[model samples]
Target: MEQLICLEALSVILGVPIKPGSKGMSNVNELNVENLLFSTFFGNLFNGGPGKELFVDMNGFLDPQFDYDFRYCNDKSICKRGDEPYKRPCGWYRFALKVLNKYPDGNTWLGTDGWRSHSVAGEWPVSYHGTTIENAKKIVKSYYKPGDREKYGRGIYSTYDIDQAFDYSREFTSKNGKKYRVIMQNRINPKMRKVCKRQDYWLIEIPEGTSAAKEKEIVEKSFRPYGILMKQV
Candidate 1:
């Protein structure tokens, strides 16, 4: 059966290896820097004035004096709830729409705060697809340190927990009378907040004969709760 892996969970199983020349930066650390600098500035700039300005990205926009934290716009209305509160003409939605329309070219100016404001440290999930269970296990083992290898004896370590969030299997008979089964797995990493768990997911497999359009539709439906996303490697 084919296996699906969460990208972030794969990192944890592999001890969250820091990239070469990364200077020991973790995802949480990067998220912090993003929130402190970019989010604080753009958030206020858009929500501060009337909701009709195109946010140009040049100049000394990073100066702290220009970094205003408009607390009024930071509520769940702008970040979470999806009703009248979110659609209010004077709300962050209007501000976001204006920015998006003006810069139909791209969202480099529209930082990630609007979509990911609810996702805090530890709650973020990563994922991968199209691999085997044995291969996945081997990949995780490859990241073990010398001490860890010595202690755990090669590919059998328990330092990290692999939460097999979903496992689905179904059998089908093709027009040629050949029988096949599709197996899919969704794996999630440990959450940042113990009480407020996040449903991080990655699909493991699609039945061999499924069309590309069907596969896309399946993944898109699964990914909606997490917001608009691009295909993950």
Candidate 2:
């Protein structure tokens, strides 16, 4: 979320040590937990498609703050050499844009290649290449806006397939006006570890005696726009 403060609370809830010095950047060789979480959010929000368009202006600005030496193979050789280092913009700037775009103050759109020019040599969008360092900082600074940081806590950042989970489990509204689903199985993974089996299913009771045909009809209706076919679970 925005503040990145109260990480102790997050760590307790997520069962992951999120504090600084707990794990260095070196430990992250691939997509980290947060990135995967964001990816899940984006995947669900757009219904498995890149919906809408978001453009970050890259113009001629190169952020010095993100400037760093990156390793590259010289002469396409499989051997290491003295000329293997090159300066490039930080890749994390793209992640900053993702967070900025998800700001609750505005509708979040998928980042697109619309911002790039045809004359550019790069195949990917300039956003992938990066934007001006000033722009990058501004994007991250926007995360501090009031009501933005807490947006992630409103269930948008859940790794669960919210739409699918809601469809599978008839939604229920609680006395406190909170809407939730009582999914029967762990849609994320069927095989439950011995330690986690207890937490696999929603503990709340779901109404019984609903016909399978009726449930299928509801699922079909929900997935019609996405052109998905309902199959027996």
Candidate 3:
């Protein structure tokens, strides 16, 4: 059997060294549905300790109430209820595609029972509270090319400039012969209003040909473990 690669192991493999205090992981308290989804996906890919698993709360992911909240901000929280803020569909779709591309198997196995239970519906089919698999799949496919941006407009906040995003998109080729594009936006979280130092939103485009297995290998070999001869101080 192949060795399971955990997050710490992946860190050593990637050579993208992370210090103990590094902000590699986001805060769960501030996590919205999409953030949680991404976290769960990545966490499952690398964290392989006993009783550790990755699971999504279908209720939270698909609930129309929460969906509306996720898209808009009410009160100080960006994801508060009753606030119909504009959501960039293109960005959301892009995120889903990246995850699907990375985890082609769609194994959906990771994390503890508590996590798993919240992730699926009655029959073990991965179901979000109010979202259909069709919608999810549709979202993933929508962001395959630059043209899709017409529907959602330019992203508000992105780490890479437009040119870089376009260039990155060209590098990856999906199984279907389609290229990838990234749409980023800047979002203001009211809760963090006091700090007001962090930028709103920055979306990164995941180039094509990047697979979950390849990422796992990268994390395992380049990120997780390194040869270090320790010296006593």
Candidate 4:
């Protein structure tokens, strides 16, 4: 079994370390000059703003927001029901994301895939990744982090459960003084996943000692940020 990480401490420390089979960690952080500036722009991504027009659709149209019925969604996860550890899309609003729909192409889009299909070969499972305000902006802009070394290995952290990911998400105030939490909804590569059971996380590993360019390549092939899930607190 692997050691668990107390996610609450992430409020101050950003050096996160965890192991496989750990029970804890539901896993972001700070405000800085760059963040201050980025936050101003990041505000555009909230509920609605001109910035959202950036994400395109299969038809190359702006803002690929899907049509969803809040009344009763087919996927119970997003139906606002408190089913269990495996169910939840509650409170969060999803912004369409498909950075480059070519390579990691699949049907894991917003209302398409379910937990049962997680084992489908060539199909990645959905997961949520929490991060600091600055990193979230950087990730949305740059698309990869090269990850960091941890007790287990060098990889990006994400969970199948949104609530767990919510535990690690950092809250930021929009220009309007409204507070919100940001989470990256992703379809992790089944081939690259390193399952951390108990906590329901996948540490998508990048090889140790990898060159900068190589690391970039690995993280891209291993992870894909496909949607932005936001919730107002």
Candidate 5:
């Protein structure tokens, strides 16, 4: 419901009040819900302002298969602070997405229960995908798409380094006029991943059963989106 309050905030910012059962509802309809998130779309997120009420919670929407507690990261290496201009300080406000059961047919990759870089045997390595706010929310609402860039031959393009992800991060201005970027935190199946260490990309080949990971839809079995990472630019 916080996301709703964010819509109210947006309406308030525009000097319009939401009248019950009126077209004011259109101000906060389904298609653009993510666009008006107060907690995420505004500038006061770190200052305990009303923007605090804008975080998107995945409570009732979670599939039973993805019901698990996700971890918060504080590592200095991968989760670098904002000292780097290209990258967002890692792991502050992460909203977990459904992932666990998305690839049930493959041998379950382990060690990603926390969404961290540390991996054990058979664990898929962690990666990051920087995208526009529109695309980020689209994947969260739906599922991951196959690679949009085919420089490496049509696979989901990602990076093991947060810095690289930041290089690809898309920037947008919020209704509040604050600039921001969105990053997808994920764990990729090493079995299907192609690492380009020199180029800093981890290209993941499309899995077989997905009709091209359900080309029209996004059921890509080779990768899973565990968290949506947003940062004010």
Candidate 6:
């Protein structure tokens, strides 16, 4: 069976060789920087690895600002659910970029607010819905009822709806197979009665002889040398 490499593994692969010793070395800093650069470059090259699949769901990450408390040194509550522990969307995107760079021809999948719950507290829209304009429109249209526009005008739903719509629009399918759909909430948010940011997905049809795991392995191994990591997280 082929092995799937993750960011840590990729980091080890890229960082270990350059360093003379496993122990502390001042020059290790430089090597680390170099590794990071290499990783970033590799990520950009592959563009999030081969799958041609996009999954849309609620943002699983947390809001960095309000979700934390710096007042107490050992405050456990400071780290809200899905905040400190996970790498979150930013890291996920970086990792994804690496995968994409390796598998440029693979399909792209996207989910709704699966990174962070929609909010109005950040500079960039506090949502992970749409990364493109067309997607934004689709999200809005899908979520809001034709005449219930005024309700979501200024609430979190306003921003959330826009972001989700954008993501939906950006999604594309290269080849048809089984289109998967996941609905987190049956009804739309009350604030935005028309918008429903549900989760939907689809996987490309693998060749007849290839198993799903085998195909994933083949793709993962292809990008291993390029410093891109591939694994189920």
**Highest TM-score scorer:** 4
Q: TM-score for candidate 5, please give it.
A: 0.55
C-alpha lDDT values of all predictions = 0.25, 0.22, 0.24, 0.50, 0.49, 0.24
Name model 3 segments beyond 4 Å from true.
Answer: 1-37, 48-171, 184-187, 191-233
Worst 10-residue lDDT window, candidate 3 = 224-233
Question: How are the candidates ranked when ordered by lDDT, highest leading?
Answer: 4, 5, 1, 3, 6, 2
Q: Is 1 or 2 the stronger prediction by TM-score?
A: 2
Q: What RMSD, rounded to one decimal, does every model reach?
A: 21.6, 22.9, 20.2, 14.2, 10.4, 18.5
* Model 1 worst lDDT window (10 residues): 88-97
Q: Distance (Å) between predicted and true CA of 138, model 2?
A: 33
lDDT of 6 by residue, 1-233 (tens): 11122222322222221112223434322222222322243333233234322111101111122222112223222111111111122112112222222334331211122334322221111122222223222222222111222332322222223223333333322112321111111111222122324322111122345664665443232222111112122
- Candidate 4 per-residue lDDT, tens place, 1-233, comes to 00011111211122222112222323211111221222232332232332222221122211244412222334654321111133446666565442433343534333334334223334456778887777765665445564453645666777778778888788876544666677776766667778775557668777667788877677777666655565667
Score residue 166 of candidate 1 by CA lDDT: 12
Cα displacement (Å) at residue 209, model 1: 0.7
Candidate 1 Cα deviation (angstroms), residue 78: 27
Q: What range of 10 consecutive residues in model 2 has the weakest lDDT sum? A: 223-232
lDDT for each residue of candidate 5 in 76-153, tens digit (9 for 90 to 100): 454311111123235434544444444545434535343333335565566788876555545544456774676666
Residue 150's lDDT in candidate 3 = 22
Top-lDDT candidate index: 4
| Clashing residue pairs, backbone N/CA/C < 3 A, model 1 | 6-127, 7-126, 7-127, 8-126, 122-192
Q: Point out the worst 10-residue segment of candidate 5 by lDDT.
A: 79-88
Clashing pairs in 2: 63-133
- Clash count for candidate 6 is 44
Any idea what lDDT model 4 has? 0.50
Ranking of candidates on TM-score, top first: 4, 5, 3, 6, 2, 1
At residue 121, give the lDDT of candidate 3. Answer: 20
Model 1, span 1-233: residue lDDT tens = 00111222222223332112123444322211222222233333333234332222222222222222222343433331211012111111111111222222343222344344243432223221222333333322321111122221221111111122112212333333443321111112322112112222222233445675765444332221111011121
| Overall local distance difference test of candidate 6 | 0.24
